[model samples]
Target: MSRLEVVCPAGTPAALEAAVAAGADSVYFGFRDGTNARNFPGLNFSREEAEEAIAHCHRHGVRAMVAVNSYPQAGRAELWQRAVADAHALGADAVILADLGLARWARSRFPHLRLHLSVQASAANPEAIAYWTERAGIRRVVLPRLFSMEDIRTLVPALPVESEVFVFGGLCVMAEGRCMLSSYVTGRSPNLDGVCSPAEWVRYGREGPMLTVRLGDVLIDRIPPGDKAGYPTLCKGCYRVRGRAMRPFEEPASLDLLSRLPELMAVGVRAIKIEGRQRGRAYVERVVRAVRGAAEQAARGRPLDAPDLRTLMEGGRATEGALARGWR
Candidate 1:
């Protein structure tokens, strides 16, 4: 079996170094602006930092991918274009992009720079993937979080380019780049501003023994004093459905797929991406190390000794996500 590439996250410079030291095949990160997703406070690299980070990765024989993945705002396309140009100038191994116009511009202006289709592009089928590969020379496509293993088995061989899937980390229930729930609650858009339920608008309060979390003025969840509280992303919030308060959309849980590494490899997946650029260096190091070992074992046709990552998961809970059988 071909060895699967472990594409890890690097929200900060420290995280990038940690990932490389922990044996990541490649590291993906974004700039400290609205041009890419995960545009959060105290996260992502500045241009100079990106240059240094790419150089550091190359020195360690690791590939660096810059995420210019957010859609450009109307009349502010230059910011996204500049980010793509900057990634090329910094010698990024690839630029993960979602915008059609920006992809075209990058292909035309910097033909040598490899282009990747970010999950934000929501191209899960062969037809869409083929279009991007044929038109813009996309080298790889990060599949959406919803595809099952069987779906991947069928889709991988038919694709024109390499396929990457999110094997671990936080899971998005809604189709990528299409969710506007956070935008409705907060003015920020994950697609345009590269932030969803941005930190500035998130607030916490206490009501006697219960802890309340709000995204702007809307209450998302209320955790009992001893219960673990989760970040207040609108979709993961508890809401009233059919007169009963429940989590109708999705419960707060991280995605864990280490147990399925062999299946992923058997199906011809080229890379496994970990999501969490907003996380810290410790998280990056531990995750990369565990996944590296798992991928090596899978490549060797051995049983994967998957690490128990419950504590590292969101709310100390994890799911196999859409990989679960009977998932529609």
Candidate 2:
């Protein structure tokens, strides 16, 4: 049996160390620029900070992956190219990428560097995975959050490269990196620029006894006084379609599959991912520890504990996500 790698998030240097100390096999993060999906202010790493963090992880026998997973602007490829070079120079175990051009550039420029495809590419099948691995040399592909265990098993036998799947944290309802909901409202792109529903455009207000959450002037949800208010991320927002208003895309909840660790490993999954790079160190540490404990237990052929992930979930709600084989 292959040892399942516990891939955790690290939005900052402190979070990187926190994840590593929490028993993560690998930690992934991005730079302060628009090169990553979590482009929120006060998050992400500087070049010096990234170098130091990579060295720290290596010293502790943990791997570090730099996320340069955004599309480059027209005629302005230097920024993305430099990020790839910088990651390689700092001894990153790999670079997580999204754009086709960026992947090609990274493979050509850094022939020996490991390249992992970001979930943003939406490669859920073997054909798509092979296209990148053969053409751009992507060694591993992070499967989108839209596949079931059956879907994963079917794709695994045909895949030419290794696969990583999200096991915990924020659930992306839309196809990874393909949704334009944030840009339609905030004029900020999630794929090309690495930001979705940026904090600048989010607002919370009250109407009589109801709390309303707005994203760039568009009212996403209104809750009663006692109901919890979630961050307006477009996808999780309640909306009206044909006179009825409800959360059609998905409810505001996090993904917690810690109890299903044995099944995930049994399906030939190489890595288990936790998704929350914009969160704090405490969140990073707690989630990492929980998933690590469960994954390690499963690796030893022991039953995994039903982890109490309520404290780490959004609005105290969590689901198995598409991994349970639900939805179409």
* Tens digits of per-residue lDDT for model 2, 146-223: 988778778866778888889898888899878888889888977867998888888889899988899877999988
lDDT of 1 by residue, 105-190 (tens): 99999999999999999997899898999999999999998898888989998888999999888888889998888888887888
Runs of candidate 1 exceeding 4 Å displacement: none
| Regions of model 2 farther than 4 Å from truth | none
- What's the count of clashing pairs in each model shown? 0, 0
Worst 10 residues of 1 by lDDT: 223-232
TM-score of each: 0.98, 0.97
When superposed on Cα atoms, how far off is each prediction in RMSD?
1.0, 1.1
